[model samples]
Target: MIQKLLDSGLHWEKKEFGRYGFLKTSGSTDTDIYFVEKGSVRIFMMDENEERIIRFGYSGNIIVSLDSFLSGKPSELYIQAIKKTIVRTATKKDFYEFIRSSEENLKFWNSILEDLVLQQMEREKDLLISSPKERFDRVLKRSPKLFQEVPNKYIANYLRMSPETLSRLKKS
Candidate 1:
């Protein structure tokens, strides 16, 4: 279904970024959505003295600053390549036109939103109820690629644990 949409006149620009390249920067109003073809992206925000990682997007995933993209506001988040990466991107205008073009497109858009919401809910629940070790274990079980592909500091921030804690967990 996604491939169908991508095939249906939605212009996709393929580009490569070096590791740590900024795909979207904080306070930018760019609303381009990216489909990861290879490698990973980390969505994050700088909070005072710390970098808080909101999420990691890998191959076959869509990466977007949803609030900013939808509202046409400056995004508070930054989207950065975690490694050498390939992505296909479509601008906000093109994305909306495609979404409004057909019932199928609208349905697909809704499904994407639903999945995002569900994932956020699960993440929030885990943060509230699970131990740090449990969260780390869950992430490892679900996306072991993150451990190998993303740096330890980023992973520690994403898991809401200290780097020392993560190192200890890795040893155990």
Candidate 2:
């Protein structure tokens, strides 16, 4: 999968993660980077000194920080691979060049963004209208393989529930 992504013209190298590793912020250099492949990256956003599990990405997924990468601005979010992983990246310069040179690349990114927006909207709707059980079920429905790949604690955090509560819910 990664080889196919690399063959498509993105530039990146593989990276590994410790038990608890972090991708530090680049206060100055904002690059248009993406994860061409990732085994299990735990993505998060920090607010009020609290860490919130946002999303866990699998292989063949782009991992660019939208605002930061596009605008060359700093990002508040932090992303780390919970498990060892491989990632591919493209810089902002490379991205723009690719867009101008290849309409196919532009379409690819546009489609990815569209899918992301739709998924986010669905998550928002679930937050508003779904019960905890329903939300959990929905998560499973959307990403059935995630339960096998990600730890339950992280899943609980992503679901906005305590671990104990998640355990009880899972049992029931």
Best by TM-score: 1
For residues 1-172, could you state the per-residue lDDT of candidate 1 as single tens digits? 7678678899999999999999989999868988998999999999997888988998888878988988999988999998999999999899999999999899999999998898788678668855888998888987788788788988998999899999999999
Candidate 2 per-residue lDDT over residues 30-149, each given as its tens digit:
575767365777767766776787777767667666667767778776777777676666677866776666677677768777987887887787677546788888888998888887
Could you tell me the TM-score of candidate 1?
0.91
- Supply every candidate's count of residue pairs whose N, Cα or C atoms clash at under 3 angstroms: 0, 1
Question: How many clashing pairs does model 2 include?
Answer: 1
Instruction: RMSD for all candidates, in order, please.
Output: 1.7, 2.5
Q: What is the lDDT of residue 31 in candidate 1?
A: 80
What TM-score does model 2 achieve against the real structure?
A: 0.85
In candidate 1, stretches whose alpha carbon ends up further than 4 angstroms from where it belongs are none
Write down the lDDT of every candidate, Cα atoms only: 0.89, 0.71
In candidate 1 the C-alpha lDDT for residue 149 amounts to 74
